[model samples]
Target chain A: MAVQEAKRANRLKSGKLVNKLVNEYWEDLINAKKTGKKVVYTTGLPIGPFMAAQDMAWIHGEGYGARVAARHEEKEPQTFAENKGFNRELCSYARTQMGCAMFAELGVPDDLNPGPIATEIPAPDAIVTCYPGCSTGPQWDWAIERVFGKKIPWFNVVIPYHMGRNGSTYMKGEEFEENVKYVVRQFEDLIKFLEVVSGKPYNWDKFQELMGVTKKVGKLRMEAMELCKAKPAPASFFDWSIQIAPVNYLTAWPGTVEAMQAVKDEVQERLDNGVSAVPNEKYRIFWEGIMNWNKLGWMADKFASYDATVVAGRYTHMAFWHEPDTIDPEHPLRGIAINHLECQLNLGYPITEERMMTLSKDYSIDGIVFHGARTCRSFSRSHFLLAENLNKKMGIQSTSFEGDMVDDSFYKEELVNTRIEALIESLEAQKSRG
Target chain B: MTSKSDRSSFYTMGVDSGSLTGKAVIIDGNRQIVSHSVKQLGFVSQKAVMMAIDDALEKAGLALEDITYTVSTGYGRKRLEIAGKNLTEISCHAKGANYLYPEVKTVIDIGGQDSKVIAVDPSGNVKNFAMNDKCAAGTGQFLEVLARALDVELTEIGALSLQSDADIKISSMCTTFAESEVISLVAEGHTTVDILSGMHKAISGRMKGLVGRVGMQQPVMMTGGGAKNIGLVKALEKTLGVSIFIPDEPQIIGALGAALFANDFATGIRKKVEEEQDLDKSRVPAKDCASCSVQNFQLNKN
Candidate 1:
């Protein structure tokens, strides 16, 4: 009973609130679709603020896949796609959403009825592809078109890859400034496309208000992040990740700001009292990549067993730390341009290496855990190299374990358990000698 | 181990309840192996563990209470209530390999359920390691699956694969695909020796990749049951471009490591007594590691 009470005290209320907000947002979309309102499909980039300002529901690709998996309704769509000859080795998020698309369009069998993301997410009236040259967003858009038997209205804003050491390192330079101008021009095209689909002109005033909200959330989130630098961090990265739900799904909304503020307050209280989320926090670890969402509790418990807490990570804090570019207040699209391009997913190394080293020092991390989430190639590919760099530079050791974001079978619990236990044991030995 | 005068004799038992087999080793006070036993692990892990322990005790001429300490390891380490401590197979394998071949900086262990490569520093501490238990590829189960596909006993495969003259390329990384390819090779009139050699090459190539992940070091030692397979060892040496050192009783390495740990714990010479893992099923009081300081990362003002 006491343990249950402690868990409840440690838990954040924003998760329930975010779930409510998501359901209501989806219900609003379902109702809007009935009234002939268009839904804009997106690749779940940094386009949430823009979509919300246009009053078009964002049926984000990866977000929908996560939703289908979180709700355990992925089997129907995943099987449907495999039967239709889609390669199983493709990214899991892609496979799941494709399954969701085919299942939603054609029909689900009697025994395979799934929840909203799989069955009720209506066909996209338009697609907004935004992965620059780093990935293959165009290929996915073409596949979606092939599956749906129609060419949806396509609006793409190519986020420029970082020619410098950082993704947004050259934002202040003339070349990157011109690149931002080019992307801002494409945003103008997206605005025109939205104007055609929603049958309404661009609303600059509403977008300005949304950007103001974005600024507010960023402030609150960074404040909470600062609190995590405390010794024996007030909250684990797992807790921070749960709090990021509102920021990722309902970005630019007033509710998101409130959720973030509440999280900041809760974290501040823990910091003021010098209270750790885990009872006997020993090692401060920088978790470098995405966790297996389904095994979050299992992994957290294992870390607790080792008396370690993940202090900070890219996956948990990326959405929160996205401070919009210092562009003119009149040009809101330029801020979106900066947000889309500055993301770690859209960038390569050299920059990430520096950021990880700094955060490792700031968090006073003793070790690291880089998960190979099989579904995300963008995150998994650079892990070993990044880990090697950190080890050579900072003496911060890292170990890799394979897992999937939502697919439970792909995640071998024993394998992960043994590997992690071995890592922790090794760290303990090293620390003992040091 | 520290000095001649301080050295005293004590007995300890270590049991490794592996997935496919159970191994037990008893060490005297001089840290010499007195007796050991290896048995196939049947359905019940606890029974198999006790049977192996009894076999070792008979050879050592000792009863249960005669041993000073007992440690358990391997896949079923947690199940044996007779032991007061348990360690992961990684630590045990490293310890065992280090004891036998101290010059070895790397240990590649291919057990029944999983495989791993441990890179050890000069101090006999693991510097880095990589493991693969996600799939049957490059594991003992992979060999067993192929053995069944070829209608051959597992014990004979090592000898059979060495007689082949020409190398047959087997490109499938998936076990199921590999099995089907093996069947087709047999149907196409390929000799069992050649097919077996191809399978050994495939397994070694996969293991070589795992070893390379931890940055393969020289003087590599091979432990676990897989090291007994001559064909696989040759293939691994060929793939890794270096010969490996294998212990006499390759399968009992984990058990031997546990016994060494048990002796050290009893003598209070090595790791301080602490509640490490899920042992002490008697629900004994937890003892935190004394050498460990539970605190934040101290500011390194370099």
Candidate 2:
């Protein structure tokens, strides 16, 4: 048969709202210095509630890196950092973060900076980082600290290693309790630091209330993703990836509750109307690892051409949904500590493998796509082992491609296309055999 | 291979439009390859694809209209407007290699610009595969470049490599760097055989890593242009610790696989037609000849 025309994935109405909020957030970030609002730089931890409680404007470094990549403007910042003696092998997101800081410090022209936005990032009064088993996250923060000559207050939250041998066990007994206490102590210290920076007393009630909002958003997000368990998924992982800004960057904001509700409602309406994200969906796939920001649209179309829909991705579902109900608003800091400790990245591969198996069965996934981002070793590990176990243990097929999350140059269109098509062909052959 | 009882006059064609060349294979209903042609691709002219097709048709003494179906494969498979369907090279290679050697559990294909190792199941489905991306480190183009740098014919490098006794190592992992390394080896007075041996070893080492991704199985078959290089095949066999198998014309295996798929398509259509005819016979009354004729007419019209 002739190859069908590639169609873009259907966008949700809520996605437009997310785009607006994200733009507004960017404007607020840019104007933070002038408005005397406290701005903070943070990593990809679920600390948005804390920042929101403090009424602070925050720039999520990883999120900003994704925006720069999606805009197809990562090359300049990446090269700029490389010229400053940063190894090209470092994480592209880290490189971009460092490059932007260097550019701002060096008084580089706005046009030369080539960020997702034209404006320079407002200098943060404090930076909150974490050690969640991802070295790149903390290393980038330290590098940026050195770049700015220690002018900013840096607070690092040490999230202990929670996974046991073979990734099969979580820390148990006294060790688990001690780990939570350790992180909670750090959170208390961080609160003190934030209070000093904001020049106000810490509000326990406000923090508790924001934590409640975060829990609601996480539960709603998980419910919407659960709706994808339908045969013809209403929203693909690609659509979900696009709408993550609110949950990741604006979690405690009241607008996020509405944003996530709209997302859930839109998905429900599609299910009611018998709409499919991929028309005549032939296959359901689970994507593993970070999104290739540069190829999001292109990859969506490629999968759609084969009538395959990527229904679930562990990374895209990374809202506050890592055991959302476990977080109690009454004791917010300890719950946040548990939430941080339970992150998928901090959990070992055996745990990831188990989750993938569950995802395959739950989503009726016919295959898995393992995207090994060149720089993100955190997610790149054990892909081969996972693919083997999934195939041997569960009889699910899989395929893999190597590319960077942000660096477009690392992605080869023809190579990735061939691998995807080959996967579809193999799936079809297996179906015929049955 | 198909039995003689399965033989028929119906013909199908498979075209493989690759990076450096285009190939076409024609097969009969018996799944027997009748004729094939290969043509080199040129920058401004993709006529190689059509030319290969015409040549194969001419040799088979058939016209384009006589062919029941056409399936195209390889890098340029989609660009073939006349193909009934296009498939990835991974599937095609596995199908073709399995057809050649029914026991083949894996296929290692080294093309001009890229190389792939495909794991095949017992039923001839692609189990898994891995390929080198955006690199010419272990491909036909890499060998072609080094052969020119050594002032030797492409056809002679393989046999020459076999004659070498001293073990030389080509340390560079890139094709361009390897060429410069080869030139420097010549300046250092290394024999042509030794340098060729080093190049073969380097290419085989790279192929080993690609094969490792899919977990190589026994009864391995090697295809594509690189399969023509005897030294590379020997080196691969040694590196992978398994005996390798090669087809009579390894480069056309993808086209042959496409031809097999075309035959399957034509067979499906023939079966459906026969089934409809049987249904029509069953629906009509035996005594009512005139009514039967009318029903048959309506069925054909629909």
On TM-score, the leading prediction is 2
lDDT for model 2 comes to 0.82
Candidate 2 lDDT over A1-434, as tens digits, reads 22556665665667777777777778878888788789898996768767767778888888888887787877888888888899987998888878877777775654564644523777778899965778778778878888888668888888876655532354345556777899999999999988998899887888999988888888888898899899899989988888677667766765888888999999999999998888878889999888988888888877887889999987875334556787799988877887777666776666667777877888999998888888888877878788778877888878787788888777767667777888888888778778
Q: Give the interface RMSD of each candidate.
A: 6.5, 2.8
Give the residue spans of candidate 1 off by over 4 A.
Answer: A1-16, A34-36, A80-87, A113-118, A132-149, A163-182, A318-321, A325-329, B1-10, B41-50, B65-68, B184-190, B268-302
Alpha-carbon TM-score of each model against the true structure = 0.86, 0.88
lDDT of 2 by residue, B1-302 (tens): 23456547789989988877789999998888999998886521269888999999999999999899999988788788888888888888888898888899999999877799988877777877777744567888889889999999998899999999788999996789888999999999999999999999988898887777677889999999899999999999989999999999998999999998888888888788878777776563345565454533333434
Q: Model 1 over residues A1-434: C-alpha lDDT tens digits?
A: 00111222244444466677677767876676787667777774656666777777777676677777767877677777777887766667777888888877888877676666677778888888777433646667668888889878888777776555323453445546767788889888888888888788877788778877776776787778779899878878877766665656567755777777778888888888888866777678888777666666666666766677888887765544365435334667777677666566655576667767877888898888888877566777788688667877887767777788766667766567666667776787677668
Fnat for the candidates in order: 0.31, 0.40
Query: What is the DockQ for all candidates, taken in turn?
Result: 0.23, 0.40
- How much is the lDDT of residue A324 in candidate 2? 72
